[model samples]
Target: MNRAVRIGVQIQPQHADYKQIRQAVADAEETGVDIIFNWDHFFPLSGDADGKHFECWTMLGAWAEATSRVEIGALVSCNSYRNPDLLADMARTVDHISGGRLILGIGGGWFQRDYDEYGYEFGTPGTRLADLAQALPRIRARWEKLNPQPLRDIPILIGGGGEKKTLRLVAEHANIWHSFSDAATLARKSAILADHCADVGTDPAHIERSTGVRALQGSSPDDVVGDVLDAGATMFTIGVSGPSYDLGPVREWVAWRDEYNARQG
Candidate 1:
């Protein structure tokens, strides 16, 4: 089945109180976003180096109860932070809480500060990728062995653009592939992903293409969104940060999504 265009909002949990963060999630859902995401990190990715930040999965558990209609997950969880089987159990519990609306977006660990502060080994890029490769199957296996299964077969969304290992993992395991690439790079990487899918015997079309967009409220939809769609991306995410989480851009993107999906139909 061809995937429909969808809008996702990532409410960055930095420099904000839990009250404000909770409100942002509610507002995004109320504005009609299809998915709500938060990043997995120990500290702020931007702004002050020592800013207020919240942990990922625990916040996701809260979102599962707080939200009713929007799918919720991390934009991409760092694989090194938690054990594979434990992560699977956490995801499964969240899935049940959300009544089956979880998307397990994960990636090989980055951000050395998170590793250092948390006492996890800050390995080389290749080592991290190899760890992720080994973890995916274990996560899946644990999901099956859990006493109470996940409310649904939770969708796996993998984020990264490495043509060799990351894209290969997308082919072998991901139901969705998220990347931060422009149209040309997206097109090139997508072709590489298709080849990887062929090697794994998985249909490339089965993996939904996701990418990040910025300032959706300021751009002409045709010029900004049309190009990415042309490049084969259908899930467009806008990330907003801080104490005052804004939903104005999210509403605009939701409108754009409706218009685009109508046109596709």
Candidate 2:
């Protein structure tokens, strides 16, 4: 089936109290976003390096109870932080809490500080990718062995743009492949992903194309975002940071998504 155009809001859990982050999630859902995401990290990705930050999966568990409509998850959880089986169980539990609205967005670990402070091995990039490759199947296996199974088959959303191992893993495993690329780069990488999909005998279209977008004030998002749509992307996400966690851009993107989907229909 052709994927619908959707908007996701990544409410970055940095420099803000849990109260404010929770409110931002409420506001994002109220604004009609299809998904609400938080990043997986031990510390802030931007602004004040030592800023207040929340852990990823625990926040997702809270979001599952707090939200009723929008899908909730980490924008991409780091694979190195938890055991594959444990992560699978966590995702399954959250799926049940959300009544099956979880998207397990995961990626090979980055952010050395997270590893250093958390005491996980700060492995090389190749090692990290290899670990991710090994973990995906184990996670699926554990999901099957879980007492109740998942509420449904929780969708796997893999995030990254590496042409080598990452794209290959997306072909083998991901239901959604999220990329951080400009329109031109997205187009190129997408073709590469398709080739990888072909090698794995998975339909490229079956893997929903996802990418991050920045909403500029007074700008018509269609030109930039439409170019990405033309490149086969359908799920567009915009990140909103805290202390304040503004949802104005999320509202704008949700409006665009509705209009875009309506026009497509």
Candidate 3:
């Protein structure tokens, strides 16, 4: 599918109170972001390590009821945190609440602190990836068996750059592939992803390429964003957090989204 360039914002649910976080979501939607994301981690990923932090899926459920336009989800929920079937039901429920605008961005568990504090096993990367590989199919099967079903086919987003396994999962299952990859890396891995798609009998062009704005490298005329676009990224996201959730970057990227889409037209 030929998708228009889109802008997303990850409203990091850390170092801020819920009321403040709620307002940030409102601000992002009003600024015209295409998607809103929050990550799945038990505690703060930056700043004060013990700062105020909220849970992921619960916040996403609230976002479904709160926002009227922007698509909402986790930047990447840890697959080990919840059972695949339960997670699928939770996603279906949120999809209904959002009127079918949920993107189920998930990945193998990371950040050992979340695992240790939460009393879950902080398994090795290999174990975590294996578990994630097992979870994806079960998630889909459960999605099919749910009452009322998802309002739409929930788009799956796999976030990771592991060549041997993560990219293979993306090729086989994902509708979107997000990574913190630079243009050269994206170009190379996208090719690898294509090879995986070929092996899995999936279409290489069907997966929409995504990246974080800060992950992009280069200081060109377009700050190398154009290079990432050329390499296949259509969805670009920047993260905002805390005391005052700034929307200036969000607004700037929204404008960039519009310009890129218009140019495409």
Q: Return the TM-score for each candidate structure.
A: 0.98, 0.98, 0.96
**Per-residue lDDT over 1-265 for candidate 3, one digit per residue giving the tens place of the 0 to 100 score:** 6889888999999999999999999999999989999999989888999989999999999999999999999999999999999999999999999999999999997899888888999879999999999999999999999998999999999999999999999999999999988889999999999999999999989999999885232332267486788898999888888978877767777886787789889
- Residue-wise C-alpha lDDT for candidate 1, range 103-140, written one tens digit per residue: 99999988999999889999999999999999999999
**Backbone clash count for every predicted candidate, in the order shown:** 0, 0, 0
* Every model: Cα RMSD to truth: 1.0, 1.0, 1.9
Q: What's the lDDT of the predicted structure labeled candidate 3?
A: 0.91
Distance from true location, Cα of 78 in model 2, Å: 0.4
* After superposition, candidate 3 runs with Cα above 4 Å error: 215-221
Judged by lDDT, which candidate is best? 1
* CA lDDT, candidate 1, residue 103: 100
Tens digits of per-residue lDDT, candidate 2, 1-265, equal 6678989999999999999998998989999999999999989999999999999999999999999999988889999999999999999999999999999999998899999988999889999999999999999999999999998889999999899999999999999999878778988998998899899899987889899998888886686585778778889898989898878877878888888788888
Candidate 1 ranges beyond 4 A from true positions: none
lDDT of 1 at 250: 76
Residue 75 local lDDT, model 1: 89
Residue 224: error of model 2 in Å? 3.2
Candidate 2: residue 138 Cα off by (Å): 0.1
